[model samples]
Target: MSSKRESPLEVFLNRHDDAAWRETLVTLLPAIHEVDRNAAQVWFHFYPLALLRAFQAAEDPARLAQELLMQGSWYLKDQLDASHTFLYGHRFWPEVKRAVVQLAGGVEIPNGRTLAEVVREVARAAAAERKVDESLTIGIAAVGLMALQQVGSEEFRRAPGEVLIDRRHLKRTPEEVLRERAKDEGQGLFGFLRTADRRWTVVWDENADDRRFKALDKQEVASGAQADKRPWHETDARCTVNEGPIPVQCRSASCGTCWVGVLGGADKLSETEWRERKVMPLFGYVETDDPKPLIRLSCQARAEGPVSVVIPPWNGYFGKYLKRVREGTSEEAVASS
Candidate 1:
């Protein structure tokens, strides 16, 4: 099949403004978010149009993502569930409803909301609560952002190689990955980003003078230094943008170790797509290639746009197995199609 004609979501992502789509999402977001309209607009700038359309009506995509993303924190998950409390809430139906319930609780829970409205509400809530700092939880949010960007942007093309044979939740513990990340922080992804810019800052703690993470992304993130820790913070200090050769692996797509999480730049980075089975999560972060996904494998993720993301400490090649199970269980899959 030639594929159903590109959808409105596709058109919207291509900078095409469909009045119906605009009306749909706009109707859902709170008026409060509308005041700072540009911030909400940023989501449109980075969100993938295709994915947004898919999730707007479907609940599983959004729910499964939340389940995976929230895997790291019981407290956060409870908080999320608390958001549901009464009624079936969002557990069993359209993904948009769950999203609407999750982000727009307390206030802004009136009338009808389109996916775009939900998107705007979410961005505003995220901006408002720069406070909740569970790295894992935040990481999940990053992946969601990435999915949006992947669906809407033109950045994604065909997935590169067969690095990821499957897409599923990786069970590695944070500490496990952290230890591994420590070993390669300087030589892997960090090395790549540093070579691109000297002024770049990667902070563990968003607020810190002379934040450690900053210049490290621009230069070598010194290894073997007690000073260089697993999840280090940038001093928030200023520096010169040094340019150098970025050291990388599978600059073709073999190693899953070079993913980074963008903390600040949602607009500057190139858009992403569901490449090689959405490899990031399989590698251990959260698989998603959203233009603005917080987690991205450095080797696969390239940026022409400016964005600041956290570097995931470790990675692996387990996606192939995951893909096999999914394919095997799927009925009518030709057994080996």
Candidate 2:
């Protein structure tokens, strides 16, 4: 049997690099998360089409998977109904998902629209229908587009209509969640004396009520996981693949497996040093000069106060590959000239 052909929207999504998408998403960051814009930005970095495309194009995917230290599910299609769970706008997923399908199905191929335009159009429509803040729908709309790309137009149209989130998760409103994200517990009165051994809470997953670990003052985020002796690997697939609440291979920054997105309390962490600054871009995770950025290697970041972080589903070394591609393109341009 012949394989199915890709849809125009899928082709469009596949054509752009993470930077292009980031440029658009960053502009709407203030609209996506009321309190945790940085964290949401990090979440976008969690999944990259370029990385997924590289994996798909590899000659030996299994071997490449090993080299990349991939864990959990990278393909958004497999979790289409619930992929936006981590985003605050997850509450609007049902409407957003439906809008994505309707938009892709109704539009003609090569409509001359960028992915950024599509995201805004869907978000604006969903907000108008839901009568909620437009900001609430922005992230979900972006997620819906990603789903459409991963599953293709046909599967997207046929995707399940029901919401996949557990009913229990609906107890808190998005506004309440935003308030919680902005919360910061101060050290007790004795803390001012500097005599108490200060400790802080690190929330690995915000959606979970009890998914947290404690870290001592100035303790590395990954190191605190060592104190949690629970059989985490038995429960979380990511933990199963690697070792801690945050999957880490080289605790010394040799491997990019321990990278995470700080949803809150970025300033509470230690400043980004030279070694981490150099390796993050090489790991293809972050490219910034900020001392403390949203994206960070868990092994290198030390907590000074309570923080919330999101671990990516996969990790890899793709900076060299991207650099080579850029050089090749430059050479072609020179020859053409």
Candidate 3:
């Protein structure tokens, strides 16, 4: 809950309940501020904008540089973690930071930069170096700026933005908003994942990961290993198996069957992904307008680690339905015009 137009701090944060914002601050205090008992309670009173004012107040490049780096570092390890699961297996920071380095490579940028500041720097660097698609690049730079800072400093506080961000750094990606809201509302991850445990032990089938009925059309379960073996669809419908029947439909992205909400083990799951984003609307469950929602189709979504999830029964041709609605609106627009 933030506003589009820049306005006073109170006005920018006008929509969302203060309680949730304060709770997030409270939750992040230990990792971010690392303040004392009295100060922790007062941290929410200090908005990111207020911090920005202080950061900008100091004209010292060395001091500002130190602070900005700390801020960037917090964004990666602490703040972003609030929403997106920072995964392993990536050395791609250079590609993302190409422009940021080429220009600022020599000239010093304020290391105490805020999310907004780092983004602006990326934009400037991109313009200087001639690059497009600076958006994701900026995000990577933010992560990098922080990583570099962590190597040097200890104190860092991230003034995270919720959806409809009022300030710069608090600006959140849709995925982040979903995750934050889910955590705040106790709706599990993106209002789907919850703390849980998988009862039945199952092997990882990358191919099967994207299937509604992993237990179906498979010899592993049907193999004549023993009488106890049964298709998990029948045996695990109640969410009791170590490997449950992943909710699915169309055995394709066409239907969002295999859409399972995480119960206890969200970290065990892999990540919200490209294909998952492509098919989410097809299921009619529009948690967020994000391209990828953490709640994913079991068929399309895979878990790198073990995860426990609750499967939803209801399914609809939501993508088609949304298209129809859009078309109808377009017709209405024509008539009105």
Candidate 4:
């Protein structure tokens, strides 16, 4: 049996646990604007290496991160470039790519440079090169470097220049684009009166005009997409069920596939339920007691008003395994005492 060598970048990433990443995110948050800060949070939830590490640490792991279903193409070596298209900073992907590669290729890992410092340095450099605010590219720059750490420099270099965004969008600045995403068209003076049948727009992809679907008052986000009946799978390969923009399996909370990040209008969604609250942490998506957190199970959360959401590329069930691992560790500790 042969074992592959671990890169220094991978080793560096391993040293930081989930708490370290969350702290680094908070450190970077002040530098990033509101929109990209939300994007960064979603990106962190989407590809949590901590979950991957938990799986690896288990004695008899059921599956690896890549083995999870409906995770999209990003986990594959060839799809690395397209991994972060959902981020607002995607417009500056070229710059982010170069910065990640340069960092990944470094032979020496600086002793005092934590993940936050590394992200800041790369983000500042990209922001300077693009002449845009660090807020725009900082999150995506973090996304790129974290991705390189997860996928390894060998695979990261394999997929170069994919650059999936449309050329028309490239002309606009990230600020202009983010503002457009935050824009909400009023439903009129009588909108509140028309409570039962009111329609709200759920912006699935902020960058595209045709990616939105209408949801009636108090309808689940996934339910609205399922009701669209417009053959969404043709446009997005992940939308395999009901031809909806967001991918889903088992309309109930049993499957974690329908998790989404509310980039805007989180207040408009229904509060969290026991099932959703319990499963979110198990799915390793979130660990929040907040009733209407940014991360939500679309199938479980109903939209009370218009919402802007970002669908993750993958989903899995690791809660049971993780729970067992924790219980085993506890038992071992007690026995040792």
Candidate 5:
């Protein structure tokens, strides 16, 4: 009997099943940003799957980073379908074309090709002229090209340039917005309790509108009610409050369970402790010297002012795993298990 052929998506997924691909994708992610106006929307769809794949890869960071640099735009194709799924459901190239056409004001994209193909073409053009660095620019340029195609080249070059989709046309600056929020909250009989100095807002999950927390100054945002205090892996109950629970355990950064991605207000939080800096890399989450980076240990990250953060869906002792990989004992450990 003849065997069935695997679909392109299946083939891509299978190719990345090895640890190397996943690790490389994860290492490259922080540096990857949206290239065009719709880049954020496109990336948002791909991030979860990309992160999941990275976590599953369980490879050594040193090797992963090197692979990412060498692979360049070729690496992005593996996760293209996943990104498309985020916006167009299970539909693939056909749906992507439709969406692109719709966004382009019904202008048909010449040559039937997927978004990834178009991005690769753009990257190649830039590389030909030596106008862009393949290592640093290709990944984001691909994403930007998707957004550009969706918006159309004509509109992208128009006056004031309709490049990115600006949903928030706020009249106030970030500081002004925060100031107004503080003023609005400090109005009731218990207004003193809600003073700017005493309390602040913690947007625990930027994607979830309801995940915002009204927290006290210098309070440990990860701690929950007595009933909900359980190790994050052991139970779903993290820290419980009136707003809802924020994930936690050990309340000390030892477990690596409460790590979060800081979306805004990095400057507002306390500086990273030596322990956090050392441990975060092992977790394969983030490795940077910036005192306040996008990644933070929620248990250790005390809130002093209003801030927004993105909680990863899962966490673990990936640092230890990475150590094993580096030592060449990871395969042995897996085989033994």
Candidate 6:
């Protein structure tokens, strides 16, 4: 009797389960450039599972990251085109092509290489060099290779045979970065009062030198102090870009508009409260017990100290879309049939 075969989506997902994906990311992170790594990390957090469903139904089985890189602008209509920013920035694609070719034993990859092709090459290299079983899935290997190529190796030693999560790349330890920013801002006559109060720095844009905000001790930064009106609160001017700078509405987590990815200071952020915990999954951003995950609703996260964060270029109500997919009622599923 013949056995049932798993679908491409299932096979891909099973090969790169959450734990394995995270492990691979941690391992290859050192090889990726700091800027690219930061951008990729944020992109990883914002990856939409809804798109995965769409791809599955469309019979187009591709790497989730690659799909995002190629077609995310259409699906995430409200987002600021993060894929274009990262993939095209500083000639990133050429570097990835070079890494893929090197891993393929100097064989020239065809121009316009797809994510699956690059991953297959990396998987072959990893299995041969590491002497690991060939059963390792290409999805996991691809993510690892992509990260490795993006984050080029540091000057110390050869790349590890077995990848491990290295926390050293976390750059500015939250506490230190926040403290220095606060000091640099300088408090005058109220310095004594401010000294008594703990302040944290929220680096909203990792790429921008000036895109940062100060949060007073124990105060939720999302609250938007009267003295400093947040960009989201400015209604007088129209934003020229889609997904304009930390676009937010309703300072509370109720709007799901203030989501962000913690790039450097996950530990320094306030623990996830019940409201945020309940609401985040609803936003389809994250569903985990980790008190301070990379994806967070800015309104819900209060800073204990300094943190570097990346604001996702878009936000929307996709919880219902996911629910419909799970229930087999999604329009994509019906249309595909």
RMSD values for the candidates in order, in angstroms, are 16.6, 4.1, 20.3, 3.9, 12.6, 11.3
Alpha-carbon lDDT, every model: 0.33, 0.73, 0.34, 0.75, 0.46, 0.50
Candidate numbers, best lDDT first, in rank order = 4, 2, 6, 5, 3, 1
For all candidates, the clash counts are 50, 0, 28, 2, 5, 6
Q: Candidate 3, which segments miss by more than 4 Å at Cα?
A: 1-244, 247-250, 287-292, 330-337
- Candidate 2, 329: how far from true, in Å? 10
Which residue pairs in candidate 5 have backbone atoms (N, alpha carbon, C) closer than 3 angstroms, thus clashing? 36-144, 37-164, 224-239, 224-240, 282-319
Colliding residue pairs in candidate 4: 71-313, 71-314
TM-score of each: 0.31, 0.86, 0.28, 0.85, 0.48, 0.55
Q: Which lDDT tens digits does candidate 4 get at residues 137-220?
A: 888888877777676767677766466778776676666766676555457876667777788889988767888999888898
lDDT of 2 by residue, 1-337 (tens): 0047765566667676677778878777766656435645765677666666655655676776666656667666666665556676777777887777777666454567767677888888888888987877887788778666656777777767566556777667867766675566567666656625778888877778778888888899999877776777776555634345777777898888788888778888899989999998888888998898989898999988888887766677766555644565523234544
* lDDT tens readout by residue for model 3, 47-151: 222223223334453464353322112123344222121211012233324533333334334344334454446444543444433433333343333332321
Better model by lDDT: candidate 3 vs candidate 6 = 6
> Model 2 TM-score?
0.86
lDDT of 4 at 267: 86
Error of 6 at 106 (Å): 11
Model 5, span 1-337: residue lDDT tens = 0033433322322333224333443444454332221223224322333333343364564454343221111122333332322111111233223323333343334544444444444444444444434333445443433333222334333313121212342122334434432433344688667655576677653323455666667666564222232333332333334323555556776766677666456676788889999988766566679898667887777776667665544455555555575565866347555
lDDT of 5 at 272: 87
User: Which sections of candidate 4 miss by over 4 Å?
Assistant: 1-9, 54-78, 234-243, 326-337
- After superposition, which runs of candidate 5 have C-alpha atoms over 4 Å from their true positions? 1-197, 207-209, 224-244, 333-337
The count of residue-pair clashes in candidate 6 stands at 6
TM-score of 5: 0.48
